[model samples]
Each structure stands twice: as structure tokens, then as C-alpha cells.
Target: MPSKADADAAPPLPEPLRVPVADSHTHLDMQSGTVEEGLAKAASVGVTTVVQVGCDIRGSRWAAETAAAYEGVWATVALHPNEAPRIVHGDPDGWSRQGARQGGGDAALDDALAEIDRLAALPQVRGVGETGLDYFRTGPEGKEAQEKSFRAHIEMAKRHGKALVIHDRDAHNDVLRILKEEGAPERTVFHCYSGDAEMARICAENGYFMSFAGNVTFKNAQPLRDALAVAPLELVLVETDAPYLTPAPYRGRPNAPYLIPLTLRAMAEVKGVSEDVLATAVSANTARAFGY
Candidate 1:
């Protein structure tokens, strides 16, 4: 049996987590602060909406509840890679479907397809992801596992006719290829886009909106900022990916959506647009992708 010490390590902090605007992708249910308290801060700072996505079945249920309870909140449901282990290894009967090879519970992927139908009926369920590849960290074995789950998520999004939210970390080429092969949504957004200028151009051509987080403001992210310069206004969005990618100025703190305005200001400066204009554009694009 494994000890508590055997649990996996935590994700590295994304640096200065202050957000001054809407957090396009966040797990409010997983935050240390109470959901209401987290939202209060967001409201105070002028964040208009929050896309609370799930990492699995239970998390997706939490996403639905958060969306239903909060005025400015919306939700999405899908199985994140980290939680994909349950589908193949656990009790097979747990998930509604079969043939997948999981090593553990059907918690995350078990009811994914079923929940896709159920959650879609919810008034506040907006999109279908926080799903995609994470090859940078996942080795060959893990990457293979993540890909199997990813394919299922893409199919689920199609069945529901919802915009697909993607998470790509260091697997741009693989992600781009798979998206090309399976075809991403006609209205899709690369949440926390980390690709460079060239990839940004490709994304623009393919009609994939690129949502930048606080990292764009960092000195090391000239490429991302430059990508922003080339990407059209209609396809650009901003987010904090809060509790993670904290932008500079307030980099070492716990993040919330209210801090998203700072990112908008930075984006506006880079794009040569007004903060109001940028804010409005981001909101509109978010609605378009989310259908809310």
C-alpha cells in the first residue's frame, strides 16, 4: 500500500497570480477560499464571468453547482488528464461505457459521456473542456494515456455541440496535429495559449481564439506577447487561469478573476487598443465560444 507521502507533487506556481479580469478557466470549487468569498472579490474587481470547469465527474458536478449558484459564473465538464487514471484501471462497470483501460475508479471518465448529456441540459453549463494534451510533463506512458482520454473528450464536445476548451502544455505539435485530424470546434479557444507567433498565425487561420494568461506580461514571454500582436482582435481573449498563472505586479499571491483587468491592460498595450475595447472584445469572444 502507498503512504500519504507517496502522493504526487503539486503543480508549479505560474508566477504573479494577480488577475484584473475574467478568469476564463478556473476551478473555484478547488480553491482554499469559500466559493462565495472568491466570487465576491471577483465582483468587486469587475470580473464579468467565470468558467468553472471540472477535472472529473465529481468536480464536474461541483462546476455545475458553482455555475448555478453564482450570477456571473458559468460551467464546463470534461475529464482532465491527471484524473484520467480511473477509466482503465479501476472497476470497469463504474463508467457507463467500456473498452477503455484504466488502472483504477471510474470517477473522472466513467460518467463523462453520460454527464456530457446530463450537464448539457443544465442552464449554466457553458463549454466542454479544460481538456487537451500535457506532453511536457507526462512521459510516453502518461502521454499515451492522456491522448486516449483526449480523443474521447473531443468526441463528447461534438456530440453536445459545445465549444471546446483546450489545454496545451509543451505538446503544441501533437495537439495541433490531433486537432487537425479530429478537427477542433468551429468556435474553439486555446485556453492559456503558450504557443509562439507562428503558431498564433496558424490558430488565427484556423479560427481558434488564443486566450493569454498573466504570463504574457513577464519579460520571458516576448514571444507570446509578439504572438498577441499578430493575432487578430476578434480571436484574442484574456484569463488568469487563477490559483495558477498569476501575472506580475502581484505575482506571488493566490489568484482570483478580479485581477484579470491587469492582464487586459497589458494586452491592450500590446495590441494598441483601449482597455474598454479589449474588455468588451474578450467578453464577447468568451460568450461566442461558450454560447452564454
Candidate 2:
């Protein structure tokens, strides 16, 4: 797991924005704070909608339940690519699906995908990921399994007609290649987009949404900022990816949806637009991405 700063060191919330926006991606289920507290803080700072994304079966279920209970919240369900190989090697029997016991690595993956599919069908689950290539973490032995799982997620998203929220980390080529091979969903978003200007142009050509996270504000993230500059406003969105990737001046601290204004403002600065205009465009793009 990545190191985080002391929670006590978290920065105070920034000023609320004149125009509200949606956090296109977040992990509310992993936060130390209660969902109510997180949502309240977010609303207080003009973040009116949040799409809570899940990276595993348990988290996916929790995301769906949280979305059901919260009016301004929505859910996206999927297993992380790293989680796929773990399911294949770990206790397959440790999990069950539709009252049936899984017996092996493949069985375990199948069961997990089955459960993810079931969760994706839920009314409040508007997306089918946080699923994609992650070469930064997974090794060669796991890559095959990860690709298999990713392809399955692509199919699931299409079947459900929901957004495909991708988690691409150091494997942009494979992520795009697999999406092309399997054919992407109508609404596909590269969550916490880390690609460069060229990749951003490709995404623009494909009509894929690019959801920028706090990392875009880092001093060394010129490539990401370049991507943001080149990406059209209609295809751009903003997020906290919270409890992680807090924006500059507070990079090590825990992040929350309430802190989104900081990232949004940074994006506006990158695109040379007013915050209000950027915020409005981001919110509309987010709604289109998730169909919310």
C-alpha cells in the first residue's frame, strides 16, 4: 500500500466554488471517515455529485449499498487487475457465488466476476469498473489473468450499457489495445488519467472521457497537465480519487471529495479557463460519462 500522511495533517477545506461539479471517481468505501461526513464536507464545498468506485467484490458491494442510501451518490463496480491474480492464486474456496463454492484459481476468478456482474446490474451501479491494466503493481505471472479479467469487465459494461471506468497505471498501451480488441463501452472514462498529450488526443478521437485527479497538480506532472490542456472541455472531468492523490501543497495528506475544488481549480488554470466555466463543463462531462 502507498504511504499516507498523518490524518491530523490534512489541510482545511478550500473555499466553495460558485459553480458546483461532480467527483467523477472516488473510493468512499476506503475512507476512515463516515460516508455521511464525507458527503457533507463535499456538498459544503460545492461538490454535488460523487461516483464512488469499487476495486474489489467487497468494496463493490459496499459502493452499491452506499449509493443506495445517499441521494447524491452513485456506484461503479469492478475488481482491480491486481486483485484478479490474487483471486487466481489465493483461496478460491474463500469466496462463493450464487450459493456455489469455487474450487480453483479459474473458478475463483469466475466467481468474483459473477458477483461483479450481479453488482453491476444493480440500479445504483452506473459503471462497470476501476478495472484496467496496472503494470506498476502486478508482475508478469499476473498479467495474463489481469488481461482476462479486463476483457471480461469490458464485456460486462457493454451488456449493462454503463460507463467503463478504467484504472490505467503504467500500462497505457495494453489498456488501449485491449479496449480496442474487445470494443469499448459507449461511455468510457480513463479515471485519474495519467497519459500524455498524444494519448489524450487518441482518447479525444475515440470520444473517451479523461477524468483528471489531484496528481495533475504536482510540479513534475507536466505530461498530465499537457494532456489536460489538449483534452477538449466536453471530454474532461475532475475527481479527488480520495484518501489518496491529494493535490499539491497537500500532496501527502488524505483526500476527500470536499477537496475537489483544489483539483478543479488547478485544471482550470491548466486549461486557461475560469473556474466556474471549467466546473460547469466538468459536471456535464461527468453526467455524460456515468449517465447520472
Candidate 3:
């Protein structure tokens, strides 16, 4: 049962997709509903698969367990860029602000990352990320820690033969530099990819997957649309990034995997292709990207 506010925040289900697809990135643990309910709703609308992304040790553990328990869910493990700084500095303020568990200093950061490394090897864990530089949240003080964590996650992904899922925000140059410096995994993805047409071309050149989310449908998101427009269909992936970035006409509403049709439809319109064609490509691309 949902509270009144929760009920109101949730958008009505969009029309079901004619072709099934996978949500390349999402956070089921962050959403309001139970995993079972969320999966059922998503499957009802042709979102037959999802990759549960973890932002911290606890969330990572939950993601691994949930993926192991669920048939259509895979997991990706890593500390968020903002989260890395908090762990390295023993700053409880950030986690406290988010009402999440507090961690310790540099030692704790190492241990936490170790746990993520362990989780990354899980049979159900298909990727190592949502990790990268985030200049938006953490300031200059946190940059070193974020980079260290990002490099380590990249190694973990490669060592485990898993996809490297990136969370690049306002740090595109640094992110690309680090990936090139450390050698990106064979299957690297830009989760909630936020770059321009040039960056999309760069990703295409590198054979990296660019996953677009619901935000691409925003009125002020023409730049994102422009990136999508140039992104090769073979490299394009779709996601809800659920519980955030709900598609337009429902921007303020709480998002769920079930609402993917709206975002995918909007993407097709932008790409000048039919819905079924985009869906087919995205479905196949997601499978190869995540090794599902």
C-alpha cells in the first residue's frame, strides 16, 4: 500500500511496448514498491528485464541478493562518485543527509570497495559501476577519492569480465581520460549518458554503449536529444533510471520500469525510426552490453 503522496507521485502506466526490451540501468532498491511488485509491473508493459544498480556497500549487497532471487533482474555494484568521497573522508554528513548508513575513513573506503569487488564476481552481477567522476555533487576536495574509486571499479569490471557502467556527470573529459588511461573494459556503458553529439560520436568510436534515460524527453534536454540523434542505433540503450528522471508529461511523477515505453517512444521519434525498430535494437544492444 502506498501513502497518498506516493500514490500521487506515481504516474499512470504508459501504453505497453510492442517489442520487449531491457532497462539498461535502474535502482529497484531506491523505488517505493517491493521488488516483486516492481518487476511484475515492468513485465506487464514489456520491460522484461532490468539491471539493479547499487550505490554503496549495503545497496550493493541488496542488489546482488535481489538479482540472485529474481529471474529477470541483473545487478551492477559500485560506490557512487559522491559516495566515494564520503567513505574516503569518513564524512557522515553526506550519508546522513541522504538518510543512508554512515561509513568510516580511508580504511573503510578500501574495505567497502573490496566488498564491491567481491560482489562484482557474483553470477548475477553483470556490471561494475554507476561509478565515475561527478563534479556536480562533490567539490574539488573529493576529486582524488572519486578518481581512485573509479579506477578501481574499472579494474574490477575488467577482472571479472563484466560490463563497466559509468555515471559521468559534469566530468566528461576527466571520465574519458581516466577510461583511456586505465583501459576501459571491453563492454563499457555510460549509464544515464549525459553528453553531447560529439561525446556520443566518441563513445561510438570506442564501441561504448550510450544508455539514454527518461530525462532525454525533457523540454530543456535538446542537447541530450542531439546526442541521441547522432548515437548509432547499434550502440543505443534505454533505461528509466527509475525513481528519478521520469519522462515528460510526467516529469514530476515517480518513475518505474513500467513507464519505459514513454521514454523509448520519445527516443524513436527523435531518432526518426519506428518504435519496433528502436526496441529491437535497444533490446539486442542491452543484452550484449550487459552480457545477458
Candidate 3 local Cα displacement, residue 7, angstroms: 8.8
Tens digit of per-residue lDDT, candidate 2, span 1-292: 4344454466798999999899989998777678999899899999999999998887898999999999999999998888888787764443444222355487778888999999999989999999998999988999988999999999999999999999999999999999899999999999999999999999999999999999999999999999999999999999989889999878888788999999999999999999999998998899888887
- What stretches of model 2 exceed 4 Å from their correct place? 1-7, 91-103
User: RMSD of candidate 2 to the true fold?
Assistant: 2.9
**Candidate 1 vs candidate 3, lDDT winner:** 3
TM-score of each: 0.84, 0.94, 0.94
What is the TM-score (0 to 1) of candidate 1? 0.84
Model 1: lDDT of residue 100: 32
Q: What is the C-alpha RMSD of each candidate to the true structure, in Å?
A: 6.6, 2.9, 3.2
Residue 9 of model 2, lDDT score: 69
Clash-forming residue pairs, model 2: none
Q: What tens-digit string does per-residue lDDT give for candidate 1 at 207-263?
A: 998999988988789999999999999888888787777777656555667677777
Q: lDDT-based ranking, best first?
A: 3, 2, 1
**Per-structure clash totals for the candidates:** 20, 0, 0
